[model samples]
Target: MSDPDLLAKLFQGDPRSIARSITKVESGSEGAAELMKAVFPRTGNAIVIGITGAPGAGKSSLVDKLALYYKDQGEKVGIVCIDPSSPFSGGAILGDRIRMATLGMDKNVFIRSMATRGNLGGLSRATVDAVSILDAAGFDKVIVETVGVGQDEVEIVKTADVSVVVLVPGMGDDIQAIKAGIMEIGDVFVINKADREGVIRTQKELEALLGLAHRPDMWMPPIVRTVATESKGIEDLSAAITSYFDFQKAETGALKFWSDALGLENVHTEIVEDQKVRVAMLPIGESRIELLEPTSEDSPISKFLEKRGGGIHHIAVEVDDITASLAKLKSQGMRLIDEEPRIGAEGCLVAFVHPAATNGVLLELVQTND
Candidate 1:
């Protein structure tokens, strides 16, 4: 990884390099943090999907099918399966090589299984870092599949852009706690094993429960029924996910996760117009979030919504010297979307790096007068 060429290979979507990067992160190698920081600018393009549910609820099966569905659409998929740790071995017993045999055959699909290894918190970050590696390596979709319906699983799922809570028919009132907790997190409700006897009953129960629960985002969680073995309802499930992704663009709830994680709160909010479209600005730290929800449907973010629904708005990094940095970048022959600095949110001078320069990620460089 110290070799510049070897490190560069991972950015080119080399599978071996990607695998080695994940291994380093999983093992907490010394260079792992630096590597992640370097790749951060290239991330935020891929869709993160979290699949979680109780054991035997067919969570993995649903993930497998949904991933396959995405692959069928010619998208590269990445899967990180969190398996229970074995006290004796301390390794993933059901490794990716063994469990996802079919997905393994596809060069475009990268699957890794991680053992809980008694470090639930560490495992969550490691799993997230692994997904970032795949995303930087050009994966279009990264799905994190975790077992059980506990707090640890909930924490891991919180890192996802969209989360799916898997369930099966006949769990009944015995799973009330799960419903209460998981229902609060799930963006999509999945009823797998739809061929079961109590399929309709489960759907009715989910609908009734959803009616009782309210989300601040106002995005209605869709119930999708699927028989994973037969790959039934996968298209419907995919559609449901895409629909939700679109619905969240106008809301600030999506950025709330990261803002809260960073222990930062929105200090001031104001509306700014760009090209006849109104966008919201919520300032944090020395940077501010330029929200993409547009007042008009003709702006760039609006077109982005029509095409890809809601995706990453942009990654803005602060720089001490914007002009000098841009000059150096130009001399280095990097493609820049904004050739000169302009006033962005909070009156910060900013410029953008073209996606061609950063692995399909839109990046903004911000500089403050201070």
Candidate 2:
């Protein structure tokens, strides 16, 4: 809303306000940037758990049971399900699962379904924004259940605080986990449908695989058995989740202390609509650093991130006149990614130089509104 007090109402945990904010963010409509900028600081209070596995791994059942466990303990829970998109409407095929019918009735629980909308990662960009809105709205626990598209689901790591990979009691499921690279991203492994035959064999195979994988953090992931229908082992699964969360909290606190000591102030953060990116600017003396995060799979920055992990994307230089600079570069035989300067974040006119022209370094020229 144009009214500045919307954020205040959002922090008060009003469901209506939270739903409206999430809608604005999902559509990328006007004022969305302002809303998210205000929302970013109030987040980090909720624990985001990401559940992923192959199709029919009973991820939805697992999520439902886990959420009920949290709600019974007198905590507010938020659930975001990424479901397959309808080809015609581009909406979630399964808006809300019938299995969650019971949990949906609780006022303390919030449930929403997001469509992948053709995103290969099985996680739409709006999913993260939705989680942030819930976290800012004082939800104690937020659960994100992926679309369950095996390999491409690895993108869940970017948003989840603790990633749980659900598998079934079968040899085929174990091979599926390996193909999905679960060992690298899974903080906790689950063998759902423990009552099914071959449960022991699946556990032994999973344990053997875990033994082979070495985590840099040196923490051995624990395998939990779950029977979602009977709500068996739900308490044990909850305990495993808490253990990892506490471990991360301690590590994060140390990092935050060092960052504060260095005077690293997070100056400003805003979504760059034209680039489909969220940028956070930190001014360090005369030079400033901008951290870029892609909002969609088709975003140029997303391609960069997919090809190369985190690192410098490009270098930007400020020039007095962007038009003249572009003309000069064109005449000097320097390849230009942008033939003409375009409006960028903060009303700056920006243009890019191809890497080929700059000896394999992408460069951008910016002319501030001043």
Candidate 3:
């Protein structure tokens, strides 16, 4: 029950610890901060490959086959599939897991389905964190499969060291790739279900688009044809992936470019720090509340209502170093709900500054127990 023991078990690859850790992360539990803090140092070892494409692009099948290929090569694989959350149900469809049934039973393969949960970039953020956990767990390769090519999906794939964009023949919208902003991020393009008619046309169109893009890295993205159902071209697809990995490793320029582009380290640091502060500021209660009242008639809510709109009544911020940040805010002549911080939920320490302090926006600062 102690934090240190729990962290030790988690680092030792205990399944219960792993499951509990993921739950904490998903639910934003108070213990999650300590678990991640302990696990953070062990990460950055796995090869994270992101697979994304529009719906019905055979991405699940491709991921299944690709994972199997890696397994056959004696590599342990971790898969994080991002499924769309149902607006009404507030639950994930779990469609990706259903499609990847065969790989589910394999002990060497770990498949986790994540819901976007109305997070434009939340899914990607969580997916990257999940990948980091898997990486620290010693998975040789981690595959992040995301459904659809929406902006959020593209952002998710950009986090991967190698991003594979999946497309099928006869979609009649290969041009949509440009519009979706997928062309710039793809390290390799896959035409799944290659036996379908117009496969050649789709491949040719992709080539033409790539020709026009003229990447600054000067690495030509390779197109691989795959019949995922039959496992046809799976080898070629794997080879292409391997070749690209080698090329990137050799180029150094490409590796640096992607590292800077993804900025995964910074993201991880920010999230961990943010969560730490949020947890630390929570009071020991079911729901922690920090009330703020207007200091003047032109207070934050009044100004916001008058200028911006009626939506988004207020905003709260979670910071690692509340004292420092608050001091900076106070020095700027900002109004404070309280001159000092107080206890919040889950043993967290919290403080709320009036909206007038933050350009007509309410600001809250939380510090975690860990």
Candidate 4:
């Protein structure tokens, strides 16, 4: 079938077509990028839940129960389980056979098992695309169960709408969770197998650790206890998930509303790879506000965030010639972060004037391609 026809079928919630589309992206088949480009706009309709933890944390069991709960509520559920790869075939060693026994039989529930495919983070490179396919295919809740590779699974934060860190009592899982740096990313923490011993102790430790965490949003992550085998606390888990999801939507809406009230028209967004920052341009009259979001932890913007939270990083002035401007500044005894013009977002040649030289304000000189 042609791409458009397949996409139409996929959008119609045709299970076979959805599987086919995911397979194409998973294999890096030709036209995969084009297919994803088409599928992108149809996404953001599904709430993507990423579940991760150490091995034997009962993550799969929790996922199965959670998915069934969503399915029972009349919402289409898509379950993507990342399993260890088979050495020779590079395919999921534990393919959907196990989950197929439970959820695969239901028309409203779609289950897919993806191989980690050598990604140490326990996620396949194409896993995000597979989730996007399911999202576009009209799944109301897409649950991504990772390979449970502990700390390495931090990549889950990037793709998931809400990140869930699953733990068990008496396994020292709380200590492991802290070591894995999972505490910071978890929007909702789950204590699965709550019937086990040391439940109270584990919860206390988790609470103490959470108390020490200082999120920029100042939102406290809720802890939900679950006994997945007996399906106890499933509703509570769902409620916690919903609460966080709704809170994020409200926060985002407030920001957009504030920007609208300020009359800042969003121009465009661009990634400056050299500095590892994503720039969002919003023009206000003659001046524009450039919001810099760090793409990596070691990036300069991230350091600024750690030290000063959120505020203006720099002010930029467009010039006719950026290189000449930098040279002139340097000759006049001005300290320059970039002695020569380097590429900034949107192909603009840019150079930075050090804060010391600019009266404690970092300044950028830009020469736009336009």
- What would the per-residue lDDT of candidate 1 be over residues 326-360, giving only the tens digit for each residue? 99889989999889998765577989998898889
Evaluated against the true structure, the overall lDDT of model 2 is 0.78
Query: What does the lDDT read for residue 349 in candidate 4?
Result: 92
lDDT by residue (tens digit), candidate 4, 6-107: 999999989889889888887788999999999999998999999987666778788888988888899999988774442221355344665667765766
Give candidate 1's whole-model lDDT: 0.78
* Weakest ten-residue segment in model 3 by summed lDDT: 266-275
Candidate 3 structure, TM-score to reference: 0.63
Q: Clash totals for all models, in order?
A: 0, 0, 17, 0
Please estimate how well model 4 matches the true structure, expressed as its whole-model Cα lDDT.
Answer: 0.81
Q: Which residue pairs in model 2 clash with each other?
A: none
In model 1, the worst 10-residue window by lDDT is 84-93
Greater TM-score among 1 and 2 belongs to 1
